[model samples]
Target chain A: MTERVYAGRPRPGNNFELYSWFFMRISGLLLILLVIGHMVIMHIINNVDVIDYDFVAARWASIGWRAYDWLLLFLALLHGANGVRVVIDDYVRRKGWKVFTVAVLYTFTFILLILGSLVIITFEPIGMGS
Target chain B: MYRGGEGQLSFILHRITGVGILVFLFGHVADTFLVGFGPDLYNHAMAIYRLPVIRVLEVLLAAAVLYHALNGLRIIIIDFWPAASRYQRAMFYAVGVVFLALFIPAAITMIRPLFH
Candidate 1:
């Protein structure tokens, strides 16, 4: 009984929490590759200095890079959001505060997903047209 | 199992690094979104990243990422094979060694531009 002191009240649901746990592990594995590949390509091989407008334009010109980046953005945001949800559940015991914090987390995640997908999907290479 | 050991240290660091990466991810997405506004606006923003101080922070970010990813792997191993829980302390150190191996080279590359 004492061991469960820190565990948050388990809300009865359709295995939502179970799914969240599973998602973190799976997404973490995928991100290990996606993110490291991204870092190696952008930061090591090329360096930040070369990553400017034209560089982005050229890279996004390829559908493959666009798809890869879109997947990274999607997975990273959802994985991070769920991870924070667990943190909030653990620390924010106050009901109102927890609600507000989770609300903010969800709202931020939703807005960013939309904004990021828009940028990736609607991108037009410079010099092609306005 | 005890709170006064590597398990606790890994847990704390995991939470810290996860939150830190989330904050950075938010900023990264917002900044990347600026590419839609045009090159002048985007490159103007990229100027901030070229600062020497930001270069150092980039190295720290790399360290945080490597630590979090490696430690998360440790957690997954223990979860899937509970029998391996007995060796988690050793796994924690292993995670550290691998983190340093990968991070040192990446850190050097990340910060080398600052020296040049």
Candidate 2:
């Protein structure tokens, strides 16, 4: 048995939650295609042993690969980070703990996104010492 | 806190797989970032992934991704089409069937290199 209690608070007009929900569905659909393609190419089409420096170099040498990887990195990270935030909100009751947890998650996500982008965009095959 | 049901199980699995994929993403990004350090470091890191245990983990990852993606589609459909909500349980089972169908072949392919 649940009792309804009235909390005196003004309702917000923003549809942030609605948009976030939509983003999850759309990004998830895209991720399925991107991640499957990535796995198939990296693991199935070619085995792990073959993915040495030269293979990565050649793959990243192309602009297409760079774009594909960059999109995959950004969407996957954002989607996962947002999902984690939802989990944190669900489980964390304390205001301070919730803020701190979300802060750490966002910070790490930011750094990883930048790092991943830089690596994919600036990767040079020739730089690898023979 | 929902009790036992297909809906509850689907919800729980979606959360678990989402977190699982996130963990894998962290390791993956770290390993790929090694490329900036040079080929030796990058290749060395990749070599470590070929171990039997790691290969098994890869299979698990594949399973997670498959379930998440399939269940995600179901979620999207239910969200946009209210009428489909009645078939949510059936859709969950369909996701499981599709996941296993795809995952078993993927797992076999993943481990084939190890034996050869």
Candidate 3:
């Protein structure tokens, strides 16, 4: 905690933390909605087996499903990745460890996000019947 | 014996769980990508997930998933915001309490579904 003088100038430091602080709140609120909605749709919907290649093929055929899945994918990856980023920011004390861990996390996060989205958008069902 | 284990323990556990979740995510990606190759591979891959031991593992994975998600949200607030540091202790307890509250119900729902 910093002390404020009689003057109006408040404080000076990196605003990166400030933005990340706000990101957590906003993303947390959104994650609650997104994750719950995703769970209900995918998990609790009668039969889990109904969600196959054909099911996904039908769903993503619609722009609505595409948009919904895209948002869910984007939000979840950002939310989880940023979450990991914060953990690294806090615990990885050594400079080398900090850089190494964050870099590794960021690399994997990007790979997962890209792969997940690509699969969701481009699924095909014709091969399933074969 | 676990006295005053919340602060540093929370920090250490969060890192461990985050890495664990990423590992799970990679496995999930690999399994999901198998669907693209063909249905036989996809079905076979999924059947592997249907064993009793795998079911138990899935339950643990779900627990780990929720724990990492909720706790990460809590730490993000305290670390990134100076304002949150004031109520950090309170918020830490709040996070644990709320995580248990939600997680217990979810666990019960999951477990009960199996028995029924």
Using TM-score as the measure, the top candidate is 1
**What are the lDDT figures for the candidates, one per model?**
0.87, 0.83, 0.65
Q: How do these models rank on TM-score, best leading? A: 1, 2, 3
Per-prediction TM-score: 0.93, 0.91, 0.69
The list of candidate 2 runs beyond 4 A from truth reads: A1-14, A127-130, B1-3
Task: Considering the two chains of model 3, state its CAPRI-style docking category.
Answer: incorrect
Candidate with top DockQ is 1
Top lDDT model: 1
When summed lDDT is taken over every stretch of 10 residues in candidate 3 chain A, the lowest stretch is A3-12
- Candidate 2, residues B1-116, lDDT tens digits: the string is 33469888888888999988997898788889888878878888998888889888887888888888888888877766667776878888899889888888888998888888
- What tens-digit string does per-residue lDDT give for candidate 1 at B12-114? 8999999999989999999999999988899999999998889888888888888988998888887766667778889999998999889888888888888
Rank all candidate structures by their DockQ, best first, as comma-separated numbers.
1, 2, 3
**Candidate 3: tens digits of C-alpha lDDT, residues A1-130:** 4642211012325697666656656776676567667655765452244555566566767888778777867776776677677767767899999999989888877887888777777777566444
lDDT of 1 by residue, A43-88 (tens): 9999889999899999998999999999999999999999999999
- Looking only at chain B, model 1 earns a TM-score of 0.97
Write one digit per residue (lDDT tens) for candidate 2, span A1-130: 4432111011224698667777887898899899999989987788777888888888887899999999999999999999898888888999999999999989888989989998997787666455
